[model samples]
Target: MAGPGQRGVGEPPRLLKIVMAGESCVGKTSIVRSYTDPHGAPTSSSYLTTIGIDFKVKPVMFDDIRVKLQIWDTAGQERFHTLSTSYFRGAQGFVLVYDITNLDSFQGITSWMKDIHEKAGDEVDIILLGNKCDKESERVVPKQKGEKLAWEHGIPFFETSAKDNVNIEDAFSVLTKEILEKKSCVLYDFDVVALNESKKRTCCAF
Candidate 1:
């Protein structure tokens, strides 16, 4: 039976795993909380430390299709490197965060990038996020520096404030769209998702 909305209202959404990685206190957890907050409540200013790892399940709708995002929040502590790095497998995308107010956190992104590439597959998409943009007075890492790093690695970049919910949804939406627009690729809970010329024509004809 075909439902009214989209193509398959009853069909299970395609699952996509995403991970947030960065140095400690870079606001990884806060970002997830803001995105998945059901009540639209304000994000707490208090620092929330993830001990080992945490997961949040969010189903985001793209027009008519719903995609479930299993977002893994990794502990930034060096002690958890062995545990956190293990969870990077099978993830389709990564949101690498860096605190704009902390230069050291910015510098630590190199190692995180290496770990993500080594632990996760090389083909996975990644977006660089500079968090805490609301704290302009304490800005240590310039936006140009962040832009340069992203350019060097060939990834999209966004300056976000989780507390204020600035650019959080935009970044995730862009990454999701990129992941979905790939042709003849396999993702979780689905088989052979293709957005090629044939698929596009079929969709347009509908």
Candidate 2:
């Protein structure tokens, strides 16, 4: 893991935008803070609702390639739900977070996912995150419930505790790898076409 603001000097790091979405007070902002905070500060479990939107960046290195993750945290209120659609534009990935103790929040994931695909298109990558997993005593949604929902939507699911710093890094790492693989595939296709064009030009010159 690269430290915050740490990157190579040669080429500009490729920026990938990811949006955090779910019902209000599902620890979306906490998750973002936990991931981007370099000093490993403890995130508070208290519910703090996001008003509108805020974003932060974390510089990361994967296989010697520097990448910057531009993570956007959005308000999850019903009024702001429609507002999230606007920010969905150009987002490469979405982390749908729900509190494990709140079954209603978990139920809200489907609605959020619909808005995501409606605004960001079907090709955008999504991951289902069951937050506050450390609260086992108060858990309303079971582990298999989250897994079943994720499977139904064909997206990866993770149980994370932002306050406890559990699975936060692992979940983000998996999402980053998925996005990078898609980007690498696109670049590879472009290179193949460019190489073929060069061959045609060379044959014509001869």
Top model by TM-score, which number? 1
Please give the distance, in angstroms, between residue 132's alpha carbon in candidate 2 and its true position after superposition: 0.3
Q: Write one digit per residue (lDDT tens) for candidate 1, span 1-206.
A: 12323566566677788999999889999999988992574664775789999999998787566788889999998999889989998888999999999999999999999999999868888999999999999999999999999999999999999988899999999888767665234354535354366688898999
Clashing pairs in 1: none
Best by lDDT: 1
lDDT of 2 by residue, 1-206 (tens): 33322334464566788999999889999999888983575655554779998999888876666678889999988898778779998888999999999989998888898899889999888999999988999999999999999999999999998888889898988888777767532232345477899999999999
RMSD of 2: 7.9
- The backbone clash count of each candidate, in order, is 0, 0
lDDT of candidate model 1 versus the reference: 0.86
Poorest stretch of ten by lDDT in candidate 2: 183-192
Report lDDT per candidate: 0.86, 0.84
Error of 2 at 172 (Å): 0.9
Candidate 1 error regions (>4 Å)? 1-10, 38-44, 183-206
